[model samples]
Target: MTTEVKPSPRERLLEAAATLTYRDGVGIGVEALCKAAGVSKRSMYQLFESKDELLAASLKERSAAFVASLLPPADDGRSARERILHVFEQVQSQAGAPEFRGCRYLAVQIELKDQTHPASRVAHQIKANLTAFFRSEAEQGGASDPDLLARQLILVFDGASARAGIQADDLTGLIAPTVAALLDAADMR
Candidate 1:
């Protein structure tokens, strides 16, 4: 008979950390995360060696999931600009979902002042990856300076997130016009 082993302590800790950080932000303590994940502190330490390591892994996982969610599937057949706008649409869709707590990486960065920390490093990597993705898409859409366009789009993305978090309103209306202008400028250049 083939045996199926359940997920390990490390797997449990990673999953729990991702969930808690996404829902409650990164300020929650390690003990709370361990308890929520139903794993012992000893097991967590054994797997991660330190809370910083565990937090980094969790943030990495969350970052991957966030990017994946923003990307359209291969069959979507959308233009690059459309695909980019669709990302904003997805974010807006999540606004109405229960318990939406805003972007996980942003939350972690805001909570941690020491940028040298492991979690902060992971967050910085995530932001870089996201910015690169935007640049690539902009280039594919024929933007003259994909790098500059990507930076501008990132500003719009961050501004929209901030508006949503602070005003509890969808900011896509403001974002869409900015993206439209960007696309128009790209066509001109």
Candidate 2:
């Protein structure tokens, strides 16, 4: 008779890693992650072989979720600017969520010294894709120098993330006006 195994150890590890990485940043150790996931150290090692591999998988999982969350649901019927602004709104909303921490990618970047790590590489790719998305939207909106506009908006985005992470305060007020100014400037040029 074969007994059905419950949730796989790998799944548990990934879930735990995602939660712990988001809540405490990537500085969290493998042991803690295994414990949180309710997996034995041997199980974790069996699945990932090393912390770096586990981290890479965890980062990938988080990146996928983050991008999915950024997508506007059907029926929102919002303009590009509104959608962009909505991203900030979501960030602000996170401030009130239980166990709120800073951007997971940024946290990993800070904790990991090696720029070439798989986790770091994936994080950088995600940022670049976001910037490209903003630039494309700006260009389609007929903004002169869409690249520049995208860069400026990225600054605001990064600033908001950093401020919220560091100060534990919502920077939504600052972001709204600045975004408006950006759109206005884009319109003029």
Candidate 3:
């Protein structure tokens, strides 16, 4: 016989918040979140200081998996150019999914419209990390201007993700070429 461990209330709330807010936007109410998580309002309050705190904690909890999904494995033996492209490829793959609502971090920041909010701060940090990855890779690839290339790469990423998420573009025949152009302009091999 085997026992299956159930997620604790905190875990369930985090999962619920991450899922619900991504699907419904940051305006999702506490009642809906607690209902989805099967946790009571009182329990939620006990676990988190407020809804904003819960939202930030949920985003923080999922940050590792989010980065893992987008970033290439460490020392994957690929060139910096290839590693950089890998991130876009992952985004393209994810955007193809029906449930894809664009980048959750992007959505949260936009919806909250408050940089000082805990969740917004968390979202900002996550995006900064992505930009840092691009900067590091651009430098390693010997780009003419790593800073410019990194900024351009992240802009492309954000745009592609937003366009695809909104179904405005499938991102097919789009991301790779645009990225290649940017890479070439920067003289990255």
Among these predictions, the greatest TM-score belongs to 3
CA-lDDT, candidates in order: 0.78, 0.77, 0.96
For model 1 the local lDDT of residue 139 reads: 86
| Residue-by-residue lDDT tens digits, candidate 1, 46-105 | 788788889899888766678888767744777888877887787777665666666677
How much does candidate 3 score in TM-score? Answer: 0.98
Model 1 Cα shift for residue 14 (angstroms): 1.4
Whole-model lDDT, model 3? 0.96
lDDT (tens digit, per residue) of candidate 2 on 44-105: 88889688889888778777678767655634777767767777677777755656566777
Q: How close is candidate 1 to the true structure, as a TM-score?
A: 0.86
Off by over 4 Å in 3: none
Cα error, residue 90 of model 3, in Å, equals: 0.5
Better of 1 and 2 by lDDT: 1
- Candidate with maximal lDDT: 3
Compared with the true structure, what per-residue lDDT tens digits does model 3 show for residues 88-160? 9999999999999899999899999999999999999999999999999999999999999999998998899
- What does the lDDT read for residue 125 in candidate 3? 97
Give every collision pair in model 1.
none
